[model samples]
Target: MNPKISDFGLARTFGGNQIESNTNRVVGTYGYMAPEYAGNGIFSIKSDVYSFGVLVLEIVSGEKNRGFVHEEHSNNLIGHAWELQNEGRSMELVAKCLGESINVSQVLRSIHVGLLCVQRHPEDRPTMPSVIMMLGGEGPLPSPKEPGFYVGNSTQGFYDGSYGISSNSEPSITKLNGT
Candidate 1:
């Protein structure tokens, strides 16, 4: 089943021409929250874009960014996808379960658009319109910049509990790795 989100606990109404706002209650899913909104409670239309990017990445990889773990690196799902893309191995980011039925170009385009939406700077993220066009093959997409809240380092070993602290009210996610 695909991600079916039914609620946003922190959504606020925007008035005419209003595109941004601030909140004191800083509430959102940790892995899906934009850095600015999570850090300073500053949310804008771009924040929703950031959340969409995270959701897309989750859908593509069949992995949750919050509980993701890799033996060769300390990066989360986002960092892992970013690394794979930079190395020209973006196909590796696709969920293995997709098998041969997957459309290569569509998967690549979705990943590209996801990364673009998660760009560190809100200004760098494409508006909803631009994202739709790019996904629909209206034009070539630009290269994406580094994503926010990404933690990456090369260290091959077991996760010793020094990392992986969640910041949201969502239930704790458990990742079971099999050898």
Candidate 2:
């Protein structure tokens, strides 16, 4: 079920030595959109990397990010994936459909490669060429950093619910247990 890259709607040619253009027409999938493109209408090869990362995550988890759920977290699939990777138990996040025959090493590699693509710093991500090399086992993968939009921040915004007002607030101030 491989998609022909040439058939992708967004694919285009820039011609030799031509400058790129900008437009206000922002179009792309929601969860897969790169931060820069989503925020500022800027697109680049790195934007593709971001989308690829999201795709990889979706594939590995067999979950549509549009309705992803974590029963015990404030984060989405990407954030949950990050947490699992950090805890060194990333395979726990794999889709159940993979069953027993799936190679643990291969799954880990794919997750690592996916995480590398979705690094918060666009510059930290591997280029398509480098990604191919890494995927093909011809090159060593660089360490990945925290991903974009992680939910580790202790601060959060809450709705006051008084007169339809909302306010920003930090973690609740409370004493230790039994207080």
Candidate 3:
């Protein structure tokens, strides 16, 4: 039993022996949810790991994943962090206010671990125990692969009921009844 996790709000209810489960209805804060849980109602310990990674990134960057957007890029906070890491500028991800006050190595490791937790595949994520080790620098960390919800070069636009065509007036509606 992990004393560290016993005090928090658990997202799932199941027997102690159950390792994973499925549901038809998905529930939780979307921004922190794992893709498998969000898209297929699959829930497990790894889902919690994914959420933890998101929280770490949010804490370090002082940005919310759901609504975060870089002025020059269409990626969210996760994507932005991945980009920064890829560009050899992960330090840029730290909030300006934390400058020089935070331990640089610790923050970078946190970012790396966060990215690992949010890997596109559930199996790619480290177990919670593994996460703790990685964060504590117990051993050399693995290179994080591409993360979930990367959404590269996405464009923002509004879509009305008219679809792509611009129509100020409402279109005629047609209903069919098979009586």
Q: Which tens-of-lDDT digit does each residue in 31-135 have in candidate 3? A: 676766655566777788888889999999988897776899777788889999989899999999886889998999999999998886779998887888888
Question: What is the C-alpha lDDT profile of model 2 across 34-145, one tens digit per residue?
Answer: 5555544555566677778878888998986545668887666777888899899899889999899798887888889989987766778777666767777845667788
What is the number of backbone collisions in each predicted candidate, taken in the order shown?
0, 0, 0
User: What TM-score does prediction 1 earn?
Assistant: 0.78
Candidate 1: tens digits of C-alpha lDDT, residues 7-101: 22233354435567777666566677777676566778788888888898999998888778899887777778888889999899899999999
lDDT of each: 0.73, 0.63, 0.71
Quote each prediction's TM-score: 0.78, 0.74, 0.78
Off by over 4 Å in 1: 1-12, 153-179
Better of 1 and 2 by lDDT: 1
Q: Residue 172 of candidate 3: its Cα lDDT?
A: 29
CA error at residue 146 for candidate 3, angstroms: 1.4
